[model samples]
Target: MVLETITRRRMIGISAAAAGMALLPLYGRAALEAVTWQGEAMGAQASLVIHHPDRAKAQGLVAATVAEVRRLERIFSLYREDSDLTRLNRQGFLVAPPKELVDILQQSRKVWALTGGAFDPTVQPLWEAYSRHFSTPGASETGPSAKIVGERLGRVGLDRLVCSPERIELPVRGAALTLNGIAQGYVTDRVVELLKAGGIERSMVDMGESRAIGSAPGGRPWRVGISDPLHAETVLKVLEVEDRAVATSSPYGFRFDSEGKFSHIIDPRSGATPQRHASVTVAAGQATIADAFSTAFNLMDTATVATVIGNSEGLEAYLLSHEGKWRHIPARTPVLVSKAL
Candidate 1:
């Protein structure tokens, strides 16, 4: 799927008032207007907010950052006709692939193994099947038949993918890869590095995923609201984060049917939609980790999620059930649960 088609699937929003309050104390100034740049990145609405005493310098930084984002998009965007990912998918193999592409493919393999195939990039074939099935006129409410799903499933496996510094290949003829699940987080982290290098001490970077650099200007944590997927107007909970990243995933973000049955998130193992929760939110030191786990956690149950979180350090999560209940990992991460007023 093209990144442009994903804008409607985003479910996280920054708390503007809270972010403003926390940023006011920067540079010991009584008040400071944040220099912000708002635009789209990897198909999702994105923004970069910076608190600095020099307006000119901040503006220059924002300009440079925007260029960085576009550059990375060319490497990761699936819909970009000339993107590295598209070439690999069409040719079934890429010789001397970009280092960044190799890096992410390898990272995807690690997450695939960690989640036990719950987060597979090779599921692009299945995604295509469902998209084609639902887009046709008078399509069946039952979705694609088992025979088609099984055929697609046969082509889904990270083991079938070959990646190295010298080459990357999709050995199976019909096999393809989509980095939509993790590319956003990967790009977010790369942008964070650029901002840090530009001398940004306190900022919030939302490039598909949200990551905070340092606490808000006054040392108070940045507040981010986790939206209720089923009820867009509701805030399931607000998070106080400092030097961390947060990502949320829900099948409701993009449903194939008008009745809310089939969703974009498919379980690689069963070719079934997620039926456990309304949404899953994860926080970690890196946006990449939070984003991938949030997507994978939706495919798991409470016990399985707990086991995964327990083994990963500096990781926490909040799960909102279909019944409107909230649960968090480790039981020590303070959360303010509330609805939009």
Candidate 2:
């Protein structure tokens, strides 16, 4: 996914806010450090940030964070054609996958069930088709027709995937898996666990929006401004979150065509890009679940999305449409204000 650039005004405002907050005595000891690392992981722009009381500790934390991301990337990335997942997709069943891969696959199955197929890693073929077609112009430009996309979607049933403590198998060949939806969040959780184990109290990490964790130092929650989907220049809302995770998914992130007709987020049920809502942000106890559910809710209809959010305990969601209208459901209602009001 393409990372949206933060505008000049937003950067200036954030700098001013940071400068003003830094004047406080408590903020004096906090060490804020950010690092950008390039690897063949997560397709593009995998990053990590750490805030702590000492530069040495922050450096160690960042090192551990990078190591963790690289470790997970080795297991989950599809960029490497020789990766375990690629082999599995080619060979149908993989015997004795590494312990980490097994655990992630099992957890992914749970999310698949919870979202009622809205979150499916088996959609990798669809992603592959679109990404390859769009990235390279005139590369056999055979778009998956409605029938073929439907067939692939039908094959995306979570029940088709089987796993045991010792082995994992895909019932069909060419059934690829992409952890783009959940792996980053898992990495974030791991890094947080690492920092906490090291006795670091507060921090913030944004792994391309899927994985954002912890709080700023000084006993205060991290302040995050939700970007306006249409304008990109303004923030729709500001959120105060401590010890929680937030994720946003939208068609605004990527489009396959210049006319902005084809989006990367394809609705599995319909085999089409979702046009119901421009974007959806979900806040939950775990960043991984929040990340998956945010993308799931974006593909769902209004009633389905509402039911999912309402039934979910301690989950908050915000939906923005193309017409500049917004809807706040459940826990987000208190923090979000309608511009119309």
Candidate 3:
């Protein structure tokens, strides 16, 4: 599953309006000023905005953060044939793998176990099957058959993966791993940490996943508009984020069918896209947790989603079910934006 970008990255580094749900860099100029940089990372466009009084200082920090992002992508990106992940998939194992690679694989294991395999990274074979099938001439909008999905499922178990600081291996040769579901959030976290370590307090990093290190310009809370799936241009709610991470997963973000029916987030357990929720937005102290859970929530029932979101600390979810019901975990009612006029 390629981590299709949730929204298009604008050429301009900043946005003045918060009218749309594309997570605009809507930090107005007030008591504070911001410096931003837009670049490509992890097969998608990435942007960074930092509030700083000194322009030169912020430029230096932005340069370092982008460099750090490129460094991490060498370890995680699957598009690069020379990347560690690609080498592992080609050779079936990687010896003396980088600790960062091992760390994320371990983290993915925890999420896989926590969500009862709803967040498996081992679903790449199934993705390949669907991509291959759907690209055929005169293909059906419907997905592949049960038999084809079943064959791919044999290589879809996270338990079949062996991950350690020194080595990572896939037990099945046909099994490949895609970090699309969670890597963006991890990259966001790392970039934010790099910025924070440099004594930069106010910032927002959107590396597919979004995280804010401090309040927006003028100390106002960062407002994230959650897009209504039913009405693509509508805002469902506004989540005020301060020093927190936010991620949204929508099946419609990437479609395999002509009519946009099948989603890219295929359930490893079912070998089909589950439509329990139209979209899931998770907010947490850590982007990694928010990233993984948002993907998992798309495959979960409402009750199961509530139970998990309620028990998890530092986590909040705004979910819209396929039936057009809004659900918020932990009973914390956020500000729901009125429909577009």
Candidate 4:
């Protein structure tokens, strides 16, 4: 679904989804001040916005959130040399794996099935092959040869991965996992949990992905802007969301070549670069679902994506075409409302 070659594709900026928050109503008698914190997590910029009357308490919450993010990064970060993921990829097996690692893998497996293998984490080798090819001088614009892709495909499959309470194993040699597509959302959700546990009812957690703990200040819905793939600076659409998570995936987010053909989002089933949409934005109750489905929906057709959304409650998508047209799943809904800019 999504690849995280730290040098090639880290936490993609394009998929960070929200442009900025709308103007907030000033705090009245509540005396709530919006406390903000910005930092880095899992190789991407991260931030938190909390509205609290007590700034000191909010700062403490921010500290706890940062600590939690660093803890998870030690497990999911591909850039961290000593991360559990790095050790597993280097050795092909992990003994007594962390419960968090196993839990995310299990969540990945569920989305892998829900999207019919579109949300795969075993596409790391494909990323390596393409990154190597593009790094060479005068590489072909057409991408890696079919033979090379086929060979890499042979080692890519979630079914080949074994997971249990005690250990996690990759049966196929060279098989690896990249949680770039899902881990950020997992982290965002976790931050929201921490903030909620700290008595924060209205806040926005942007830990690579974004999740609103509740409505914005003064009962207004949070506004999330979706940037145009052709023009990253242009916010093509805006979504009014409350107590929901939004994630976007764009083929133009990261390209191996200057022509913008090959992308960081790879179709694991065929080892092919996505050519379906300029971008696919998914909104769900959980940031994890929004993030994974945003990446997976790029590999699926409109009908298939629509069906998946139809079958699931509190799930919707907005697909932006290269032609600059927008397509919405379910056609109408109250969970998420969007206005084209």
The candidate that wins on lDDT is 4
The lDDT for every candidate, in the order shown, is 0.75, 0.62, 0.73, 0.75
Reference-based TM-score, model 1: 0.86
* Candidate 2 Cα misplacement greater than 4 A, ranges: 1-58, 131-143, 210-215, 230-233, 332-341
Prediction 4 TM-score vs. true: 0.87
**Candidate closer to the true structure by TM-score (higher is better), 2 or 3:** 3
Residue 53's lDDT within candidate 1 is 59
Worst 10 residues of 4 by lDDT: 1-10
lDDT for 304 (candidate 4): 95
Task: After the best TM-score superposition of candidate 4, give how far the Cα of residue 283 lies from its true spot, in angstroms.
Answer: 0.4
Q: Across residues 13-86, which tens digit of lDDT does each residue of candidate 3 receive?
A: 22221211122233333224446666676676555555455656666777887787888889888889888888
lDDT of 1 by residue, 49-158 (tens): 55555667667677777787788888888899999989989999999999999998888887788788888888899999999999999989999999999999998898
**Candidate 2: worst 10 consecutive residues by lDDT?**
11-20
Per-residue accuracy of model 2 over 1-341 as CA lDDT, tens digit each: 11112221122101101211231112123224422233333455443334444556656766776677677777777676677776777777778887777877777777677678888777777776666666775644445566667667765655788877667887565676777777766765666677677655544445544222334445455656678776666777765676666677788778776667777787665667756788887777777777788878878877787777666667777788888777877652343211211
Q: Local error of candidate 2 at 320, Å?
A: 0.6
**Stretches of candidate 4 exceeding 4 Å from the true structure:** 1-36, 47-49, 54-56, 331-341
Per-residue accuracy of model 4 over 1-341 as CA lDDT, tens digit each: 12111111222221111123232322212123555555566676644444555667767776787798889999998888999999999999999999999999998998898889999999999999999999999889899999999999998999779999799998698888899899989987887787777776665555666676566545566667777776666677777777888888888888888888899999999999867998998888898989999999999989999988877778889998888888988533456533333
